[model samples]
Target chain A: GIQVEQSPPDLILQEGANSTLRCNFSDSVNNLQWFHQNPWGQLINLFYIPSGTKQNGRLSATTVATERYSLLYISSSQTTDSGVYFCAVARGSQGNLIFGKGTKLSVKP
Target chain B: DAGVTQSPTHLIKTRGQQVTLRCSPKSGHDTVSWYQQALGQGPQFIFQYYEEEERQRGNFPDRFSGHQFPNYSSELNVNALLLGDSALYLCASSSRQVGYGYTFGSGTRLTVV
Candidate 1:
């Protein structure tokens, strides 16, 4: 089993601010994804970056597979971005994801 | 196109009782996965089904079982539930390609008293 750790357990940012969240894994992974869980308990997929970098609107993610770590970046943060951002990885054939505790982000308007 | 849809947005069960949760995957998706997310915690993978078979499972016990229909819909069954079983159960659907990200349902909140 792989261990996933997220940094900055809690973060508070002002509107239009920028922040970065990190995720580190203990082993190699074939699948990696970033998810946003809103206050209403809806888990939305933000990125599926096993490697390289991807950008979606004001949110971007980069995964350095060789280093076993990934990062999620939020720019010009808005109140709607306030939620829990989680990074999950699938290590091997099982295809089950091991998720980091998550970084709780609160964007103040 | 409809994304993943879960049944019974919320539920309440008693200890020692059994409960079932249902999920209909997104259109054109063939795989369904279940996850459990406790308060203030990230979602934990429960199991994944593909091609009408259980392809992989997490560290969950036998009490946590599931079935996937030919149409790709799925059901999660918990027998002899415990107080610890209470959580928001999420259903995610994905296609065969790894690049195709998963679409998760809003989730069913289950409370055991």
Candidate 2:
């Protein structure tokens, strides 16, 4: 089984600040996804960057497949962005996703 | 265009009892998966169902079992539950097409007393 590890288990920043969260996997993966879990426990899809870079609004993600790592970037963070961010990956196309413990982000206004 | 829908958003049951959680996948999707997430921890895969059959499963006990219907809906049944069963149970749906992402439901919060 592949292991997914997220960095900075906790993060705090001002509303207008910027930050980067990293995810390192122990093995090669064919699928990678980022999710934001709201306070009410709904997991919202953020990005599906198995590789390369993708940007959605103020958030962006980059996955270096060869290096087996991914980076999620948030620019000018908003208070609503406060939640747990999870990175999940699957070994094969049909494999189950193994998730990281997540990076809890708090954006204070 | 419903993403994923889960029933009984919250539940409370006593130890040694049985509980069942239901999930309906998003439109156009045929695969459904279940996950368990404890407080402050990331979601862990419980099992996946496709074509009305169990496809893949994680490291879960026999107490945890599930079934898939012809319409792609699924149900997770846990028997002889323990206090440790208290957690958020999430349901995700995706297409069989390779490289497709998953859509998750709000999840069902289960508490065992």
Clashes of each: 0, 0
Which residue pairs show backbone clashes in model 1? Answer: none
CAPRI class assigned to model 1: medium
What is candidate 1's DockQ?
Answer: 0.65
Off by over 4 Å in 2: none
- Candidate 2 positional error at A40, Å: 0.6
- lDDT tens string, model 1, A1-109? 7899999999999999999999999998988999998999998899988899999999999999999999999999999999999998886533777789999999999
What is the Cα-based lDDT of residue B46 in candidate 2?
Answer: 99
- Name the top TM-score candidate: 2
Tell me the TM-score for chain B of model 2: 0.97
Model 2 C-alpha lDDT per residue in residues B7-72, reported as the tens digit of each score: 989999999999999999999999999999999899999999999989999999999999999999
**Local accuracy of candidate 1 as per-residue lDDT tens digits, B32-56:** 9999998988888899999889998
Give lDDT tens digits, candidate 2, residues A23-42: 99999898899999999999
Error of 2 at B87 (Å): 0.4
